[model samples]
Target: MADSTNQSTVVAFIHTYRPDGRLDSYMSELVDAFVRCGIRLHLVITNHIVPNLDSTALKKHISEQRLIEYINDVDPEFIFTTNRGGITKGIMEKTHAPILTWMVDHTPFFHHGGGPEDLFCEKDHCIISSLRHVKVFESTYPVLKGRVHYLPFATKVEDFKTSRNVVQDVDISFVGTYFHSGILENLYNYYADSPETIQGLLRLAGKIQSDPDTDILPLIEAYGIRKVLEDFNYNHIYLKWLFVNYISLNQRIKVLDAVSDLGLRLYGTDNWLHVGAYSLNLLGCFQFQKKIDTRQKLVELYQRSRIGLNISHHQAGGGLPYRIFDLLASNALLVTNARKDSDLFHLFGEDVQVPMYKNEQDLRKIVIYYLENEKERRELVQYCNRLVDRGFSFEDRVRSFFEIAGCRLKETGHGQLVKVDPDSFIRGLVRYLYRCGGNKPYSSQEKAAPAGGDRIKKIYHRYATGKQRLFIARQVVPLIPNGIIDMLRKQ
Candidate 1:
């Protein structure tokens, strides 16, 4: 449980850049919500950015020693970060505050090189994006017992609005980046060296692609691939990398090939060209974008397309990608491959809110059905939008954080306490009414001057009335453009 008496300050360590110089939009919504909740934020920015840390905040430092010094200076009650690499023994020893790690990606991707012993610390409390991942960690690492929690990705519903200029230029669309070259090269080398192993892997990949819900580990053991790999000293990490890459890339390519006859637009990095010789033609249909405008472009794509596709990596194990929230938030019809043990069907009823497919054939059939039947698609979009509006906003997520931290808000004369549960429909309805018309939660006027000032208050009122704010809060700096802060600081 959190120390309710001293829940005022928190220090966050995050990365601000990727190798490609693209800005990560992950922390904007959380930071905005924290400020609104009357918590002061102290940011520690690290410079070494990787895919796992892509969604971190913008600040640049390469030294861990400087980070320790800064955290000690702040003396915050809680420490927060998203990156697994950012947490180390040295940093853990330096701070007494509980370290909260909110993992946004799959466990295998971050825990590949290190053993379970090196991956977790005693002071860590983990909040994962998928329930499947929580199971994976608890079963794989003994140290993670009783410290893991699951919280899915949510949208800033107030920030994502239906665009006026709705043009269905593309019948279907996919927005994501391809894998790194080094990973692909490693896969290619392994495939060339081991023919039988490669054949078994290809079959396994097919099984997963045909049905993502398939339990792959049992299949690996049955094929004797696990034993063979162990004999060759390949280790579990190498096997994980091979399995994820082969399964994910093959499935993506197969989906694209199945949907090629339809009007499809691919928006992401150019690594799709290396998938195969015929991939050049596929790459021809690719669309690129300025790094800063990626989020805006995705919303536009969702609004303009009749169908949006979300492909979760095989390692996701029934966890949803960020794209699912974005598509629903934009009020677009989504067709995604089904995952094993996914909570999506439970959250949104089977074939009622959004359609899930078993294989590429199923995906194509569903996409065509929705495209031919415009009325059904529109209704489904409206249904999903209402669902998101009710309980999946960033504000709701912040409230969940408060619950997880055991921090109780002080009651005052004007404030009303409301309970919200993301999984329950009734609680979601109650939360929606409370947010839309009831007394404003998270108001700190009695404590200190409110964060974001009157601007945020006015925006909150507009949100309640179903009016779009002039600027979305999930942008890199929430209404302020990038580089402006640097200029102001220099002055």
Candidate 2:
């Protein structure tokens, strides 16, 4: 081993097929951030995630023993991963490498609004940025508390530094697909089942004599909504929802079909592959599109693009995505329906903000404006690029990550915990929001405020749950491989 100051290596684990996701971008930014600091990074993707990595182009990245052997071979000081489903959890127990799980989205729970999985992820030493995520992890999983740090996503500006302005592929494009919970489903169905949207109803109410309050759905108690409640296993709640609404799937698909008809090179998980085969407007749909391949393409494609759209069905949970920064970095004008939430418009909205689309009308306005006012569109791109460059860029953000994670900067040379913010944290949740973007800290308050959540409860829960006993149990939890345990015994 070189014993150099920058000897640490980061490995990002993707258990599922995240061919198109923010984790990869986080990985990309981590690489640039670390390498610039002289630390090497190896992106450890699961075979499950990259089933087609066997292609000649991607063959060099293929490794049979991937994580297991790589940990042995590289003996990296740090391993950064997002989900803990299969491969990531498998790697955690199997390796001696001090693991760092970048808690991106721990499936089932994220599919629902909240759960103990977040807490479980935190206990495993994954630096978490959001307080909501930290609370979920802390309250649910007995083991993960201090292990999680407030390390925000590594947003970089370099991604948009390119001039890959090729001809526009689609006039207005958004890549997303989602399902709804009882709350969201009811809200959406109310709109879909009707001849008009809630926005339309509100407008009609203004013209006609009717009380607007009557139309409003009463707010559900925080603890009981489909989101992660303090007492419930949010993942289970969501899984149950998925099964019950199995038939309502048709109505959901119908909405997605309508969205697809408008020009966007859309693709999602395998279920949507059928939609492409059936619809004439549907040009193509694949199970997963490669991020590295797509990024290389998007660096050029976004330049010519007018309105890059993001519409999410659910508003509360999903935060700004890493891709939003990528688009801003690529200087693509982002049009989104993220008004109620904070993600895309958080930082860059001050400079080059994209308008929020309430329905197809807002979407149409953005598409046309960016199309007609070419000079204005270019200015917006430049403005967004400036925001991304200033501090919102992934590289700079992850460099902040390096400081927060307490990865001994060559100067400081000390390993410590980090303090990341809520907006970045919310963006972390948005990925779970079926194509929600991340990190929309348009104002200073979000950046400055501690991520919104019940802090006192989290503190009380820690001691009440006997964290000391749990920590002791975790130490003897029979996690290390027998061979490794024997090796240690012999030593």
Candidate 3:
């Protein structure tokens, strides 16, 4: 760990080649936090991501040799990268400073040839976004037990703090890519080439989707497909990636179909035409806009939207998404799909902080109800904003990260410790809930409620009443005799 008394510089390895801007956003917030803590940052840009970024701290390195020379010249106390891929093993072996890797991917399968264990040394530390990845590392490679940590996704709240001058022009909006081009076709061709293997894979996927609560690893083993994945003989990782995309794409289409009557706008790539031949025609029912590449435009869209939708890829394995935090920070009413083992119910009330649905019908009902009930929607927006503001800020996340990694900060006469507050206590309760309940609660009462009893009760009552009406409309009405219900409906 870096000493608090010593002045230190940290080198950050970044790849900005991708146009998604996710890495750019993360690096910007992290750099800001490090600067605030009095730590100097030297950015090492790789892969020719950007020809030039207007910053004196940035240095572009096109090869591993150059990167190593730069690191040696800087002699920084700590080295940071977003993932293992950002820094090569050769570079890691040459550097004596501690390398802190914050990984956002599902698993380090890309490092399969070198073995995931080779990425870390005694001086290295890893921070993963998914808890599942943490467990996999600890269990698969015991050497990384004490060094691995779990940190959820967060956003810079200040960046999203916008004036309420914009009108809520969009009733609901979804911003993501629709995978249809090369990867999808390749996956289909692979499956067609291997009928038996694909059949087994589909069977396993079907079982996992049917009961998401089941441990997929055990099921994969039982299906005897574990060896195929482990062999790495074929494109198993790519296959899994495509599978996740397929699941997410299907879910997004279902959501669009369910709420086609509403003003649902889609902002993403043009690949959505592969969903169906008539997908282009379906755009008539809802607005279809091209992808918004910049963060400013995205924040503007969120600010102008009444509701923001989040649909996680099935491979997330109950991990809370970055979009959830972004939506909360934007003060947009969030209606998302409920994860089978999510800690969201603990951090925020089931329906108060954010409304989550279990199925397509439930999602439609919740969206309609929230849209019609402006007061409830506004309250949810306020509650989520307050909760996110209290603890889920980018600064808070970075501070917690330093503490977890045992890196100390210098005393600038403002000696403040980042500790858990009342809001943090609510967030901490999520870990407890996951441990005790195995993230499976039979009923709403079984889930942990927040501090104020009266407020919770009032929120629950309002949510239950509206849900009951939706239930009667969808469930009860279908069961009633058609003649009598039709006559009653006519009256």
Candidate 4:
């Protein structure tokens, strides 16, 4: 056990890299929250531990040895990481600290070899994002029966609100990767050699799509295709992976393609361009104009968009994506696909009515109706926002995480803390605007601005296109950076 007397509860955060830095951002936010709770975060970047080497055996041995020594030296109360990719069985065996592995995505079977040399130790625990996955994980791995927990995606309550009135110039917005179509295509092409197997897989995909709440394993097996399973040496996990990937991509493509004509402004990677290559109906509707650079920028985009779209990944059958909460927090009129037995309805209850679509045509109709009916959309947005404010933020998740991990806070905090009041910031900005002869009260177009460093720019840009754009540019644009002002001019 760690020193309980005068020491803060140290957490060894295993920081692995993601191309878009989504997981890294989650870690950074959680670390900040835990820091406030007096947990001393010890960041261990995976790349630094083991270099990319040719010899797999040598690399594994070195990383295991290095990690063993490092864990012993740090003597953290527990090890916390997402996906458990960098963690090994040897490290788990050697360490006294309990490992809290947060599975943000589906449990990959590759992490656990076909044999018993899996990552699980008696003391280690799993925290999955989806409640449905939590149930599935426990049932699949009976050994980890009591060790799994459900902690859904959340946003910072304080940061994701509209305190300052701003205009929502954009109509529809989506912020997520289109996912890797090439990989799925290749898998399909491989089976293309076997027409029967390809057709079977497609039929299996349709079954899974229709009945999403049911496990994919059973669906695959029920399809009665021994060749598909036999081809992968009876690796059900890998097969499930391929089918779910296909279903999720299919769902996103279908829905996005349906709603593409309605001034849809996508914000994500260039992988969206491949949508057209995949389907003729898509016609590059998934093409993203801007890459949302930061969390703040994402919130701003949601805030500025009249409607924020959430297309659930196929795996998320009974659970809502974190984007649902973010869109609600940003006060975007959200339009999402209906999940079978979704956590959304149970979480919010019957009081709030969030728009959900059953199919592509339904989604298009819902989106169009919401766009035309402003009062009803805004009313629903307010209701959802209130529910989110009640308890659905990252702060709430941090507390839940600590309780589940059995970590207690120390009497006094160690890190330097700085606090900024949004109301105060808004007042100051309003005063500045007043000096610039913009004595007009909040306009019809402007709604509250979500918290961010570029908030001033969002406010400036809202009125930038209006009659006041030139006046504000002369007055406030001088204070903002030239580059930022130039960008705002384009908006």
Candidate 5:
């Protein structure tokens, strides 16, 4: 490892894949931020700057050998990735530069069966969107203790800038997909015959929404479904993904149904037209606009909409959605569901009380209140925009990333790091929110112990009985030759 002080301010930014290629906008924002900080960027991406190709396609274009050679040639000060990208230990071993991965989604998926150890070196660091993820990642992968940092999604104000003169024609806007059918749906259907099992799944989903940062295994065990999941060969991380998806689908349906009467202009896939409550919601005040193709179009929509609505993906845990910043940047007042933790109050003061709702009636009331009072709404938007300007931009994030990597910028321009006293800030934020009788901060370290109910005991016995047969086969099968085992299976 060479001294970061002696290293040149060059970075190889790895642009990973998103099916919709929405993340390319984020990559561009980071590149612009890095350039402003006097750091040269080598955009390591496929043809369109959005590496949306599958693994086979990616391998056909970029071979491991070529990637290694490219890294050796660039010899960048450090490497940055939004997700893991194609960077592997083989590539990491060939360069002195460290790796920095910003986990934009659920952290467990990254550390599932094959964890971050496969990609990150000892000095390599990662940034997670949720603080709950940060604590869990550190506790799970102890090697990367101080290497983990919490940085929620941020926007490049310049990218989202729009003309204030544009009329706010759209009353409300929502940009997301409808999870009509997927793994979560498949799991639900598989247990359709067992109402108790379905109830257990729904119960797990509800619990996850309430406390998303907690690991899912304990929750499953607590709900008396560990044996059922084991029967299907589903691991904890995979279950976590399924449960989060379930919560997201159900919650989106509920919220959209409540606000659908408010003339919501939804910009997403066609799936929204057929989903549960959305099918009925579409009949009243909902316009099914085509999915957005470009970043400019999405920003324009936000700028033209009086209220930009957000439903945080359950995967984000306590982190504010990236939409929050983008909508505010485009001068749209945001109305969102209440987040799990006090991150909302932590960023914007406890007094301003960023427009958030607890239930369907509450959502309708808040949206209508803001819509009727344009003066108050605009004032709130301006305050949040000022807060974003003071800090919380991608430029600040880029600087923080380098500072965490122990690299100093060669030249400073408009870029500045936001100085924050974590202890003081959290203390004040929590105290004020508590006084206001609002949602307080939740620590991921809090234990969520598994329940030992009679149902769970029955499941355990059944699981043990089923395992006894496999236990006997394992001892005897290995002693036989491979040819005999294959012949027996054929018979």
Candidate 6:
């Protein structure tokens, strides 16, 4: 944030690539809320995607320096940044405005986990010092202990408030990411792990994965076949067979496959190719909009949606999302797995508790009822809309920030004497390499899937996930021989 001759506070945001995609539904409301508080929000962004291509065309919507100049030109009071990389945040930290950082996903530790060799920390989740989960801003970037709070992402109330009740087109639509290859096997494993539930849930899972008769869970093979038919386009290279086989080695292949057969239109895009089955077997459902400035369009989507979907990968620390509030705010019903059950829903809602589905079986069984039960759906949406109106807007979050930041600054505390060095980097490195490599057990996908999507979604081909193929090699051999040899010699 820059010093503004103008009195309003300026808010700045950073993105991985171009400026437009970075602003999910939560941003505008956040800025509006800050402006309500008398601070003018100004945004600064890096127009680059890859570090090298971090140039002008990549930022066609807005230029990098121009963005900075705009912020400097207005010169506001507060500055906040969405981390694109260490470098992006580092620059913002240099500015006069207090820089607040938000982690959208358990992203810091993504892609690189579950591999034998360790990569850089920035490539994975970085825990500066667990302030005991307390909101403290006083450590090395001690200012963060003061400026930062474990502020989860933002949510808008539009979808839940204004969307007209419409029928959900597909029976079971698993929107986030899914593993396509071993998905079937993983599903079996989950049931096998709990054979008792197999008989009871099997029928429901089958119905959910596929609606019995009409199509293949075949919503795509039937209604949306044209959407899938377009898969031959250059956009779908990631959903191919070889790529699935590649990433599945170190990551989740079986899970993707199982989600495939459920037969609904699986949706994905974004840096979808960076990880998971974006390209792999996630074939037909891939919809790429040739990069457009789509903020207004997305806000409109929440209004049109009957049910907005948000699911987190198992390792993703609970599946809460900014869009959850956005969907609800738009008056759309949200069908999501619980993140931190107590905090997530309640934090976002006041009187109405948002509905949560436990497993694929649990979710499918209830979908029909929610659809058929329109009165109940309308009631839920209305109740949730009112709840956020009172408790969970970005305005609420920013006000909460001042209170938390203020409390910490006033605290007087004695610094602890070091009884010992924090875990040594060398030992910590060895342990993470071992555990991330394979020591830490991979969570099973079949167990990950709901009972049965006989609907036959997409059998996303085994995708390479082009990152390091650690997840793949692990499946082939419990250990990567070369990497294992290196570890033992070090030991």
Give lDDT tens digits, candidate 3, residues 381-439.
87777767767766676566567656675524322222111111111212222223234
Each model's total of backbone clashes: 0, 35, 0, 3, 0, 91
lDDT of each residue in 152-218, candidate 6, tens digit only = 5555454344435644444333334334334334544655755544443344333323321112223
| Global Cα lDDT for candidate 4 | 0.63
State which candidate, 1 or 5, has the greater lDDT.
Answer: 5
Provide TM-scores for the models: 0.69, 0.54, 0.70, 0.74, 0.71, 0.48
What ranking emerges by TM-score with the best candidate at the front? Answer: 4, 5, 3, 1, 2, 6
Measured over all alpha carbons after superposition, the RMSD of each candidate to the real structure, in angstroms, is 16.2, 16.8, 25.6, 18.0, 17.5, 20.0
- Estimate the TM-score for candidate 3: 0.70
lDDT of each: 0.59, 0.44, 0.59, 0.63, 0.62, 0.39
Give the worst 10-residue stretch by lDDT in candidate 1: 417-426
Q: For residues 406-431, what per-residue lDDT tens digits would candidate 5 score against the true structure?
A: 87766644432221111121222122
Which parts of model 2 have CA positions greater than 4 angstroms off? 1-6, 16-33, 48-76, 85-98, 106-123, 127-134, 142-156, 176-263, 267-271, 276-292, 313-318, 345-352, 411-491
Candidate 5 Cα misplacement greater than 4 A, ranges: 1-23, 46-62, 92-94, 108-113, 116-120, 159-162, 189-203, 218-235, 276-278, 283-289, 412-491
Least well predicted 10-residue stretch by lDDT in candidate 5? 417-426
- Per residue, candidate 1 scores C-alpha lDDT tens digits across 360-403 of 89988998899899999888887777767777766576666656
**Model 1 pairs whose backbones collide:** none
Query: Could you tell me the lDDT of residue 224 within candidate 4?
Result: 61
Evaluation by lDDT, superior candidate among 2 and 5 = 5
What TM-score, to 2 decimals, does candidate 4 have?
0.74
Candidate 4, residue 203: CA error in Å?
Answer: 4.7
Q: Model 2: per-residue lDDT, tens digit, 1-491?
A: 32233455555454434544334334544555555655555554433333242121112212223435555565555565554422334354566655555655423213112243432433256555443455555544557656655543445455555465466655555444434334534544645645444444334323222321121112223113333222233334333333233323443344334545455555444455455444645535222543234455555555655666554322113355555656666656876654443544343353336556665555555666677787998787777666656655444545654554566534233322221121221211111211211223232243332332223222222322232422422242335344543332221
**Candidate 2 vs. truth: CA RMSD?**
16.8
> In model 3, where is the ten-residue run with the lowest total lDDT?
419-428
